[model samples]
Target: MNLSIRWKVTLATLFALACGFAMAGFLAERSLERQELAQSHRNLDVRTEMVAHELRPWLRAHAPRFTDPAFQVLVRELGAKALARITLIAPDGLVLADSAVASEHLPGVENHRTRPEVEQALAQGDGSDLRASQTTGERTLYHAILLTEQDGSPSIVLRLGLPIVTLEEELSQLRRHLVLAFGSAFLVAVGLSILLARSLTKPLSDMAAAARRLADGDAAARIQITSRDEAGLLGETLNRMADELRAKIEEVSEDRSQLLAMLTSMVEGVMVLDYRGRVLQVNPALERMFNVTRAEARGRKFSDVFGHPQLALLVSTVLSTRVGQEDEILLSPSSRCLHIEASVAGGEQENEACAVLVFHDITELRRLEKIRKDFVANVSHELRTPLTSIKGYVEALLDGGKDDPDTSAKFLDIILKQSDRLNLILEDLLQLSKIESGQVLLRREPLQIEMIVERTMAMMRPLAGKKGHRLVENIPSGLPLVNGDEERLGQVLSNLLDNAIKYTPEGGSITVAARHVAPGGSPAGGKSESLEISVADTGIGIPESDRPRVFERFYRVDKARSREMGGTGLGLAIVRHIVEGHGGQVWVEGNRPCGSRFVVRLPVQPSDQAAGHPSLVPTK
Candidate 1:
C-alpha cells in the first residue's frame, strides 16, 4: 500500500509490545493463583492430619457408625478449629457429617461417597478438588484423606475444604494491576516508537534524495552527516561513491575526445548508424567521399546518405542479424570502387546497439591487381610457345634428322631464329620495367618534331622496302620546339614505325605525320601548346572493341599473325609506357579511307621532375 518506513516501524513496535504484555500477564496470573492454591492445600493437609490422628485410634478400636451423632459433632468441631468445612463419609456411601450442613439435614445431603475428593481419598489415601460446595453454595478447594484399621481395612473418609474466595480476590486484584500496567506501558511504547521512527526515517529520506540527484547526473548531491552511527557511515560511503563516479565520467569524456579526434583524422571513410538504420554520426572522410554534410545526414536513413542499394542492404543485414559483413561496391556516377566493412557496434541492450561501416577506395588497387594477373598469365603463355617450338625441332634433329647435313643445318638456323625472338622479348620486358619503375630518367630539351620524325622514317625505310612499300613523312617546316626526353621520344616513334612496317601489305604505304593539338582534345591547325604525332599503315585495322586495350602489355587481336611476323607483342606496350613517361597519351583509331592510325600527343613542356634529372641532348 506504499506505506512509509516510519509507519511500518511504529506499528510493528506497538504490536510486539501488545503481544508481550498479554502473554506475560496471563502467565503471571496463572503462576500466582497456583501458588495460593498450593498454600491453601498445605493448610488443609495439616487439618486433615490432625483430624486423621484423632480418628485413627477410634477407627482401630471399632468400626464406627456414621449415624452416631457423636461422630457428627466431632466433624463440625474439627472444621471450626481448622477454620474450614469438614466432612465425614461412611464407607457405605453415607454422608455421615458435613460441617456446613445442619445435623437434621445431614441425611438429606447428597451421598458424599460419590464426591470426587471422597472417591479419590478412598482409592488413594489423599485427594483434592475445587468446586462449588453443595450445602453452602460457595466455591471451595477441598482436600480429603481415608482412615484405616491396623489390618488395612478402610473405615471412614475425612475431608477438609476451604473456600477459595481470598485467592480469587487476590487474582482479581493482580489482573487489575496488570491491565493498568499494560495500558501505561502501551502508551509509553507508542510515544517512544514514534520518536525512533522519525530518527531513523529522516536520515534515510535525505539519503534517498541524494541518490536521486546522483542518478540525474548531479555530482554534488550528498547526505549531511549528523552522527557517527551506521546511518552516518552510509552517508560517507555514498559521498565517496559520488566522487569516484565524477572522476570516472571525466576520464570517459577525455577518452571520447581522443577517439573522436582519431576517427576524424583517419583516411578510411567511417560512418555509424543507429538501431533503426538512421545515421548517428559520420566522420569527415565519409562526408567528403559521399559529398554529404553531417547536418544533412544526421537523423536520416542510411539509404539516404548512401544511395547505393548494395551498401544499404549490407547495413540492414548487420543491424538485423548482428553479424559482420564486407563487400566491394561500385559507387556509381563517379564509378569509384570501395571496399566496405559493416559490423554491429556494442551495447548492453539490443535496442541500443548500432552499425559501423568503414569504406576504403580500392579502385587503383583493383586495377593494379588485374594488371599483375594478366601480365603473369600472358607471359607464361608467350614464353611457353617459343620454348615448345625449340624443344620439338631440337628433338626432331636428335631423333635421326642430324644424320642428314642439310636437315641438321636448317634445324640449327630455325633454333637460332627462335633464340633471337626470346632474347628480343626479354629485352623489351626489361626496358618496359625500367621506364615504368622511374629508373629510366628523362632528358628534356627543346627539339623539333619535324626533324625527329624525319630521322625515324629514314631509319625505318629499309624495313619498309622489304614489303614493297615506301615510308612517307608529313611534317610542316619550322615546327615548334618540343620539350621532352629525345631518346624516349625517339623510342616511341621507332616502335610505332616498326609496327606499321610489319603489319602493312605489299605495295601498301606507311606515313609518319606530325601536327598540333589544343588541350581541349581537338586538333589545331596553327602552333599550339601540344604536338600530335600519327603512325598510319594500310594493314589489318584493330577492331573498335579491342582499341581500348591495344596498349596493354602482350595484348593482341591476332596472336598467331603477330608471332609469325617476329613481333614480341611488347612493342605497343613499350610505346605506351614511353609516351606516358614523357607526360603524353597514346591511342589507336581507324585511319581515314583505309587503315588503322596510332596517335601520340605530347606537351610542349615537361613536368619539373624532367628538369631535376640529368638531361640527354639529341645526337646530330
Candidate 2:
C-alpha cells in the first residue's frame, strides 16, 4: 500500500499508453478494412464493365438466346480470371447466364429480375449490392449496369458480383499486422514510461530521503541530484535549508552552553519563575542558598521552595508591574539576611513574561555592622566615664580647692587615678585590637608549666594575702612543658589568679594546679600531648548564662564591683586572645563547694627538655 512514487507513475503511464495503443490499433484496422473494401468494389466494377461490353454484342445479336454456349463460355472465362460471380439477366426478369452455374444447372436457376442489384440497375442505370447469391447460395457483391445498343436504346441489364470473402481475408491479414505493430508499440511505450517515471522520481526520492535524514538530526544530509529541473531546484533548496538549520542549531547550542556556564559560576543565587509564579529553573547557587535541590524545587511554587514570603511577594509584584524590584529579606531555618532583586525577563506580552530573582547572602555584613555599632557605643561610654571623673575633679579644684593644699592635693590625686584608669583602658583596648587583628607576633617556645604558674602565683600571692585568702599550688611535678610565648603564658596565669583573688572573700581558698594530659584526654585530639592549668577559688561564681560572654571585650558580670576593685573588664578578654593565639583553649567552670574555676589547655612540646624541669610544688 505504501507504493513509491516511481512505481505509481510508471503504472499510471503504462495504463494510459496501453489504452491509446489499443484505440489506435482499432482505428487503423477499421481504416484498412474500408480501404480494402473500396478497392474490391472498384475491381468488381471494372470487371462488370468489361463483361458487359463483351455481352453487349451477344445481347444485340441474339437478344433472346440467354442459354447460348458462346455467352456461357465467355462469362466462365471472365469470372475465372476476376475471381468473382457473374450473372446476366434479360429485361423480362428471366435468367440469361450465371458464371458460377453449370450449363445443365443454368436452366434451373431462379429469375434474377427482382434482385436488389438488378432492380437498382434498371432504375438508375447502375448499382451494387452485397448479399447471398440466389444461384450459388454464397455471400457475394453484385454490381449491375443497364446495357445500351449502338442507337442508344437500353437492351439488357448487365450485373456483376464478386464474393466479399476475398476482401474480408485481406482485411483480416491487415488487422493481424496492425495488432502486432500496436502490441509492439505498447510494449515499447511501457518501457519508455518506466524510464521517464524513474528519471523524474529518482531525484525527488533522493531529496525526500535527505529531508528525512535532516529531520532525524543528520546535519550533513544532502541530495546529490544535478539536473536543471524543478526536482533539482527543490533538492538544492532543501540542502540550503539544512545548512542554515545546522548553523542556527550550533549557534543556539553554543549560546546555551555559555549561558549555563555563566549561571553556574555566579556567586549570587538566581531563580527563574513562570507567569504563574512557579519555579522554572534554579541555579546551583540558588539551590545551596535556599537549602533545596533543583529536582525538589522544579515545578513547585517559588514561595514553597524558598520559604520566604517577602521574596515571593516581590516576585509577584515584579511580574504584575513589569518592573524590577529589590528588597532585603531574612530567610528562615538558617536566618540568613539576603538582598533579593526580582525583575520581569521575557517578551512584552504578560503571558510570555517570566520573573527572574537574584539574591546574595548578607548575613556576615549585617553582623559586622551591628558589632561596629556596639563597639562605638561601648568605647564612648568607657571614655566618657573616666573623662567625667577628671572633669568633675578639675571643676572642684577650680572652685577654690586650690587655695587649700590638702584639698588641692587630694583633687589632683583623684584626677591622676582617673587618668591612669583611662590610660589602662586605652592600653588594654590597643592590646586586644592587636591580638584580634593578628598583628601581635607570638614568641613560640617550650616553657615549664609550673614555672609560669609559680611566677603568676608569686605576683598574685600578696594580693590574695591582703584579702586573707589561702593560696594553694597543686601542680604535678612531671607536668609537660607547653609550647607558647613564655611572657604571654605568664600573663594568662596572672590574670586568672588576679580575678580569683579579687572575687574571693576573706578565709576563702585559692588553688593553682597543672597536669600533663594525653592526646585522647585533651579536647584537641590526635596524637598530640597537652598541659592543662586551672585557677580555682571559693568566690561568687559566674552564672552559666554569663560564662560564654565573659571573655568578650569589656564584658563584665559585676560591672560596678569590677570598677570599684580597679578592674578594666578587659583582662579576661586579653587572656583569651593570648591563649588562642598560641593555639590553646581557655574556659571557665563552677568550682567545687561554691566558686568558679578557669581552665587553660595548651599543646605540649615533644622535646626532652620538658621532662627535666624542677616542680614548683608537690601534686596535691
Candidate 3:
C-alpha cells in the first residue's frame, strides 16, 4: 500500500514496455495473417483462372460428345490436386457439368448471372467474396471465367468454389503458437521485475539505515557507494553531509564549553532567563552571591530569586514590553547593606525572550561615596567654626576692647589663642588631605616602635590624668625597630592614644603595647617579621557595623561626642593613610568587654637597625 517512488517508476516502466510489446506483437501477427490471407486469396484467383482456361478447351472438345466420361474424370482429377470445387455452366447461365455435385441434380439455377463471379465473367471477367451458393447451398469462394469456342464466340462459363477449410486450420495453429509465446514472455517479465526491485531497493534501504543512525546522534555513520550511478551519487552526498555535520557538532561543542568557562570564571554574578521570565541558567558566582542553588533557582520566576517587589516588577515590565530595564535592589537582613545594580539585556530567540541579568555588588562603593560626601561637609563646618570665633574676637578688640588695655589685651589673647587653634586645625586638615590625596612623601627610617608608642603615650598622659584615666605602656624594650617616617608614625600613635584616653571613662585604663610578630610569608618577602603596635582601652567600643569605615575622613560613629571632644574626625583617616604609605595596614577591633583596640602593623627593620636606634626611646 505504501508505494515508494522507485517502485512506482519501475512498475510504470515495466507496464509501459509490456503494453508496447503486446501491441507490437499483436500488430505484427495481425499483419502477417492478413498477408497470408491475401496471398492465399490471390493464389485461389490464379488457380481458378488456370482451371477455367484448361477446362474451356476440354468443354469445347467435348461439346459434340455431350456425355463424355473423359470430361468428368478430368474435372475430378483437377479438383483433387487444388482442393477447389469446379463447375461448368452452359452459355445460358445453367449448370451443365459439376465436380462437387452431380450436374444433373443441379437445376433451376438460371439466375447465376446476378452473382459476383458470374457478373465478372460476363462483364469485367473477375470478382471475389465467399458466399453460399444458391444452387448447391455450399459456402464457397466463387470464381467465374468465360469459355470461348474456336471462332471466338463464348461457349460456357467455368465457375470455381474454394472451401478454404485447410487455410482456416493453418491460421488456428498459428494463433496457438502466438498465445504460448506471449504467455512465456509475461512470466519472464514478472521474474525480472522482482530482481530489478531488489537490486534498486537494497541500496535505498542501506541509506535509510544510515540516516537512522545519524538521527540517533551518530554523526560517523556513512553510506558505502559501490556503483557510479545515481544511487551511488546519493550515497556519496550522504557521506559528505555526515562529515560536515560532525564538524559542526564539534564546533558547537567547543563554543559551548568556552562560553561556560567564561561565564563561570567571571567575578560578576550572571543570571540568564528565558522568555517566561524564569531563571534558565546561572553561573557559580551567582549561586554563591545570591545564596541560591541552581536547582532552587531554575524554572523559578525572577521575582522569587531576588525577593524584591521593585526588582520583580521591573523584570515583569521589561518582559512584557520586550525592552531592556535596570534597577537597583537592596539585599537586606544584614548590618552591611548590599546594593545590587541589576541590568537586563539581550533579546528573544525562538519566540522566547532571552535575557541576562548582571548583579553588581556595590555595598563598599556606596559606603565610600557616603564618607566622601560627609568629609566635605564636616571640613566646611569645622573650618567655619574656627573662622567665626577668630573673627568675633578680633571685632571686639577693634571696637571697645582695644581702647582699654586690660580688655584689649584679654581679647587679643583670646583672639591669638583662637587664631593658633585655627592654625593647628588648618595644619592638621592640610596634612590629612595630603596623606589622603597621596601627595605626602614618607621619610622612612629605622625607628624603635617601642619608643614611638612611649612618646605618643607620654604626650597623652596629662590628658588621660585630667580625665582620671590610666595611661599605661606595655611596650617591650626589646621590641624590633620599624621601617617608617618618625614624624608621621608618632602622629599616628598620638591620635590613637588620644582617642583611647578621651573615650576611657574616669578610672578606666589605656594600654599601648608593641611586640614582634613572627615572620609571615608574603609574596614580596618569603618570610618577614612585622612590628605590631596596639593601642587598647576600656571605653565605649566602636560598633561592628562602623568598624570598616572608621578610617574614612570625617566619618564619626558619634558626631556630637566627637565634636565636643575637639576631635576633627580626621585622625583615624590620616593614620590609615600614613600606615598604608609605609607599606603597612591599620585596623580597629572590639577589645573584649566594652572597649576598642586599634592595631597598626608595619614591617620590622632588620636586626642590625635595632641596636643602632638604641636612643630611640626618648624621655617618656
Best by TM-score: 3
Each model's lDDT comes to: 0.83, 0.82, 0.76
lDDT-best of 1 and 2? 1
lDDT of 1 at 533: 92
Model 1: CA > 4 A from native:
1-19, 43-84, 99-108, 123-125, 132-139, 145-156, 186-423, 442-490, 506-538, 578-620
Per-model TM-score, in order, reads 0.58, 0.64, 0.65
Q: Who is ahead in TM-score, 2 or 3?
A: 3
Question: lDDT (0-100) at residue 554 of candidate 3?
Answer: 75
Q: Which ten residues in a row have the lowest lDDT in candidate 2?
A: 611-620
Q: What is the lDDT of candidate 3?
A: 0.76
lDDT of 1 by residue, 1-620 (tens): 88998999999989999999999999999999889988998888887898788777766775566667777777778778888988877776687778888888876888777888888988897889999987788899999887766696656788888999999899999999999999999999999999999998888989999999989988888889998899999988988988898899999999999989999999889888878888888889888888899999988878876778888788878888988999989876778889999888864343354888899989889888998998999888888887888998899998998999999999989989888888888999998887777777777776778877878888888888888987888888756567787767888899998888788788998888888666566443324367889999898788899999988898888989998998888889888877776667788989867779999988775444334545653221
**RMSD of each predicted structure:** 10.1, 9.4, 8.4
Better model by lDDT: candidate 1 vs candidate 3:
1
- Predicted candidate 2 versus true structure: per-residue lDDT over 1-620, tens digit per residue: 88889999999988887788778878877887678778878998888878776766766776556567877888889888767777777777776777778878866877887888888888898888877876667777788888867765556777777878876777788778878887888788888988999899989888888888888988889899689789888888888888888999999999999999999999899888888777888889988887889999888877777656777678778878878898999877688899987877865433343878888888998987876786687778788988999999899988989999999999999999999999999998998888788777777566778888778888888888898999999987877667667777888888888889888888899999888778788655646777888889999999999999898777789888888877888899889888887777889999877899998988887676555543231111
- lDDT by residue (tens digit), candidate 3, 467-555: 89987788777776776788889988888988897777889998888777787733234277887888999999999999998987778
Clash-forming residue pairs, model 1: none
Model 2 residue 561 CA deviation in Å: 2.8
